[model samples]
Target: MADASGLELVEQALGHRFSDRTLLEQGLTHASAEAGYSYERLEFLGDRVLGLVVAGLLLARFPDEDEGEIGRRFSALVQADTLSEIGGQLGLADHVRAASGVVNDSILADVVEALIAAIFEDAGMDVAAEFVRRHWELRIDAVTAPPQDPKTALQEWSQARARGLPSYHDIGREGPDHAPRFTVEVHVDGAEPVQATGASKRAAERDAAAIMLSMLDPESHG
Candidate 1:
C-alpha cells in the first residue's frame, strides 16, 4: 500500500481524490516495476479519453475552423511534448514508481494518460473530462494562433491523419560551404512528395514542407 499522505499529495496535484487507491497506485507504477498491474492499459484508454475530450474542447473553442486547421491544433494538444509539459506542471515525476525512480518525457506523458484513466475508473467520465478541460483548456487559450510554421504545420497535418510525421530528405547541396544552397524533399504517406531549395538544409526543409502543404490545400494551413 502507498503511504497515506503521499497519495493525498498526488490527489492535490491531479485536482481529484481517488476512491480506489489501488487504481492510483497502478497509474503511477511503471512497467519495469513488475507490480502485476502497470500503467500501460490505463495509458491506452487514457489516450482515447483525452482525444475525445480534447476534440469536444476544440469544436467549442474553434467552431469556425475547417477540419484541417482543427486537426493541427488537436495534434499539438495530444502530442507527447504537450502531455509531458502538463505532467511537469503537475509535478508527476516525483510521484511515479519505477525501478529507476526516474522518468523521461515518454514515461511522464504515459503517466498523465494513466492518471486520466484512473480518474475515469474511480469517479466517472464527467470528472475525468473536467480534469482534461481544466488543464488543456488553458493550453488552447495560451496559443493565440495554432502553429503556422511550414514544417511544423506539415508535421502536425501528417500526425493528425495518423500517418506519423513527415520525412525530410536532403537531395543535394551546392556552392561553397559558407554559401551552399540545399535541396530538400518532404514525404508523407498518401501524399505526393514535394521539393524545394534554400540557402540551408533547414530552410530547404521548411520550403519543401510549405510546398507540400500548399499542394494539399492552398489555404488549409491557416
Candidate 2:
C-alpha cells in the first residue's frame, strides 16, 4: 500500500519518527476502510501497553494513595473518553483513515491506542512508554483526587442495599459502521433496568449506570 499522505505531520504530532511507516499507516486505517485493514490487533496490544505505562505512572505520582483510590484514578485516566480527549487535543481526527473519512471519539480513541502499539513495534516499549507518559502525565497531575466513576458508584450503591452486583448488557446498536452508537441496559435487583447510549459500549454502560444512580437518588445528579 502507498504511504498515507502527509505522514510526517502525524510523526510530528506523535513526536516519534517511525522507522517503519507502514505500522503507522496500519494504525490509522479503520476496519471500515476498503484497504481491508484495521487497528483491532494493534489496539489489543496497545491497550495493554497503555495500561502498563499508565499504571506505573499512577503509582509514581501517588505514593500515598491506596490501591482502591489509585485504581479509580487509573480507571478515569485510561477510559476511552480520556483517550479521545487526548487524540482531539493532538488533532488526530484530520489524519485518521476511516470509511466516511471522519473520526469520532470512539474511533479516535482506538486509533490512539493503535498508534501506541505501532510505536512500540517500530522502536520499543520505552519509546511507547515515553509517548504515553508525555501525553498522559498532565491528565494524571490534574486528578487531585480519585473520582467516583459512575460504575463504581452504582456498584457501591447496589451492594450497600444488598442488590448484589449490577449487570450490564449491550441491548442495542445503531448507525453506520464508522460511527456506531451502543445502547446498554443496566439491571439492578429490584429497580427497572436503565438504558443509555454512547459512542462505545463502555461509555454506554457508564451512562446507564449513571442514570440508574440518579434515578435511585435524585439528589445525587450532580
Candidate 3:
C-alpha cells in the first residue's frame, strides 16, 4: 500500500533503481489496468531481452557443448515454470500490483518478465543484462546440464525396452479453483500406475512420472 516501502523493497530485490520512477511503477502494474497501467508490452520486450541475455551467457559458459545440447538447455532454463519459480523466489507476487482476482503462477511469471522489460526500458541493456545475470547466474552453467524432466526420460527408457507409449491421467482433483491440487496417474507400458499430486495438473503428471522413473531407473533419480 505504501509506495515508498514497496519501492525500497523491490529495488533491493532487483538490485537496481529506476531513473524513471514511473517505469518501476509500471513494472508492478498488472493487465488489470483499472488497478493501473499494465506492463504487458514491457513483458513482451522483456521476454526477448531475457532470452538474448540468457543465450549470450550460455554461449560463453558452454563452448564445448554442441548446438542441440545448448538448445535443449536453453529451452529448460526459459520455460514458464522455471521463470515462475524465480519470480516466487524473489517474492514478486507480494510486490506486483495486480487486481484482486489475479491468482495464477503463470501470471506471476509474466509479471517477472514484465518487470524485466521495465528494467530494460528504465535503465538500459547493460543494467538489464546484469540484473538477469545476478538472478540467473547459478543457472547459466546449468544450461549445458542434462534434462531434468523425469517423465520424458522415463518414457524414452520404456520405449527402448520394447514398452509402448506412456500415458497420464488426471485421476483426482481437489482444493479451490484458483489453486486446485491435482493428482495424476502415470501408466507405463504394462506396469502398475504410479500416482503423485501437485499444485497443478502438469506438475502432478510430472511428479507421477518422476516416481515411476525413479522406480524404473534409480540412477536417474540421483
Q: Quick one: best TM-score, which candidate?
A: 2
lDDT of residue 150 for candidate 1: 81
Q: Which window of ten consecutive residues has the lowest lDDT sum in model 1?
A: 173-182
lDDT of 1 by residue, 59-170 (tens): 8999898888888788879977689889999999888887766676667888999999999999999999999999999898888777666888788887887888999998
Better of 2 and 3 by TM-score: 2
**Positional deviation of 204 in candidate 3, in angstroms?**
4.1
Error of 1 at 154 (Å): 6.5
Model 3: ten consecutive residues of lowest lDDT:
140-149
lDDT digits (tens) for residues 1-222 of candidate 3: 328788878888888877886777777776664554777788899999999998888888888888877777777777767888888888777777755655467667777888888889888899999989988879765444656577677778888878878999878888654346789898987678999987777778877887888788754344
- Model 2 quality (TM-score): 0.86
Each model's TM-score?
A: 0.69, 0.86, 0.77
Please give the distance, in angstroms, between residue 14's alpha carbon in candidate 3 and its true position after superposition: 0.6
Each prediction's number of clashing residue pairs: 0, 0, 0
lDDT of 2 at 161: 79
Which prediction has the highest lDDT against the true structure?
2
Any residue pairs clashing in model 3, and if so which? none
Which is the better candidate, 1 or 2, if ranked by TM-score? 2
lDDT measured at residue 79 in model 1 versus the true structure, 0 to 100: 76
